[model samples]
Target: MSTTPDPTYHRPVMLAECLAALQLRPDGRYVDVTFGGGGHSAAILEQLGPDGHLYAFDQDADAEQQAQQLIRGPRGDRFTFIRANFSQLHDELGRRGALGLDGLLADLGVSSHQFDTPERGFSTRFDGPLDMRMNSEHGPSAADVVAQYSEAELHRIFGMYGEVTNARTLARTLAQARNARTIHTIADLKQAIQSCVPRGKENKYLAQVFQALRLEVNEEMEVLQALLTQSAQVLRPGGRLVVMSYHSLEDRLVKNYIGQGKFFGEAEKDLFGNVQRPFESVTRKPVTATEAELAQNNRARSAKLRVAERSSLMLS
Candidate 1:
């Protein structure tokens, strides 16, 4: 039987900050939505006494298995692992009869495992197949998008998500290349991108392309919207919704959701003077990693943590 190692093995991003934002209550219920390496879950468990219960959710089967091993230890009974995406949090919590959560956490973006593993296709450093599905069992691979999307659509994805300077030119290049032959591997894709863009800073250019592809492959923006909506609903009044986003696109969405219930804009008040908005922004500005943390973990540099508390507003 494999042994459950210490939480250090996973290296939870901004661990101290997340715990502080959570503000754990010994007797209150808590949820860790992205139980990637169980680092956050283990930390939350440590804070919980005998009566406190922690429910965790992770779509990846491997994450579930690791969580199972951790839960089987001394603190086993208090831990519950769910094999599902955080977007369906409301329904899943309802089915489990959970309510009035003390705190909820979502560590968004890709995990270390995805980037470290070559076949996952998240990193530009690896020369693997262009498969970037978070859940390999479902959804279209990154290659599918490159092979199928129209030039205009590809340009939009690269420009919007990756912030590529020459997205239009790159998109046209990709379209022409695909017409001639298929792009099967990361090396092939990188070479195609290099042909369009100059040789200087190749890694930066390739990274942006990969970012655009991964974001589209995972449908990250759509999934984030659903998860954030569910998080607001599932959290009880005054319950904290702590989210750590790695990219500006996601951080912007989180900021808007916290300040105003919708992404379009904050709701305007009528002459009747009725208030609107489901959550109150706890952090007006997103919190970033400390210099110390950034020095230790380069990944923390891109991490931005935004917190919100549930309000009395009822869904219409």
Candidate 2:
């Protein structure tokens, strides 16, 4: 049994890009949907002179608690931390009379806190229990998914979430191994995978397996879709929707939603021959981190930032 690694300080991805995309107004209201280390939130607060209000959301109990402590300075009252999933962001803000935000920032991906914490079961480097719930209070454990999900279901999960090359083979292997033994711990699951998966890059393969399990446990993609759909309605006209996605699956969703206003193709055209995209793409291509940022943070390698401004299209 190996001891857990020390929790490293989390650096927000594309800090400058996030701040610029928000287009902060002195009196504007803003939302940081994934306030991991509260870096982005703190930046927004700095831009907000006095009348600006910043509302941050983090589903993870640990993150929420940390955010409460982190925002304890002079500008504390201006920043409100909500301990709930951002899928229902609009409703949560609406209850507090926060309608039509001036801008919104959603750094959509697993946080460093979740990945570093051994007990969270997000990282393969750590030998923790097979638990990967973002909220920590809800959802089925990764162990349950590994033990209960059918081979086909597991295959779909790995293929969709992790983009694992041998998803089918891995899924079948998990299904076969788990039936004979109760796969309760992360070590048990990793060993089960290793039995079928030939070791080349152990870390890479384990990362994929862990990522698949985490996505299945948290339903991250589905929640992201929900949040994106709500963004068009919640943001004021000319308000910006800036997002940072770590993977292609998430980037595709963000790209499509911004361009077509839905996950699929564009809606029908009017007599004026307008394609009717609800949000105009601010950056034709996703903005990536600079060499300076990448040199300091390995996690920024996969980060892609997309920005869009709300169109005149009213909520349907």
Q: In order, how many clashes per candidate?
A: 0, 0
User: How does candidate 1 fare on TM-score?
Assistant: 0.94
Candidate 1 yields a Cα-based lDDT of 0.85
TM-score computed on alpha carbons, candidate 2: 0.94
RMSD over all Cα atoms, model 1: 1.8
Clashing pairs in 2: none
Please give the lDDT score for candidate 2: 0.85
Tens digit per residue, CA lDDT, model 1, 1-316: 5435345436689899999998898887999999988888888888898889999998876687789776777887888999888888889998988867889999998778778889878898888998998888788899999999999999999999999999999999999998988998888888777776657877777778888998898888998999888887788899999999998899989887777677766565557865477888888888899999889888888999998888977775
Residues 1-316 of candidate 2 have per-residue lDDT tens digits of: 2111123536788998989888899899999998877777877888887888999998877777667654666777788989889998879999999979999999887778778888888888888989988878887999889988889999999998988999999999888888789998889998888865656878877877888888889898899999998888789999999999988888999999888767876666669987676799999999999999999999999999999999998666
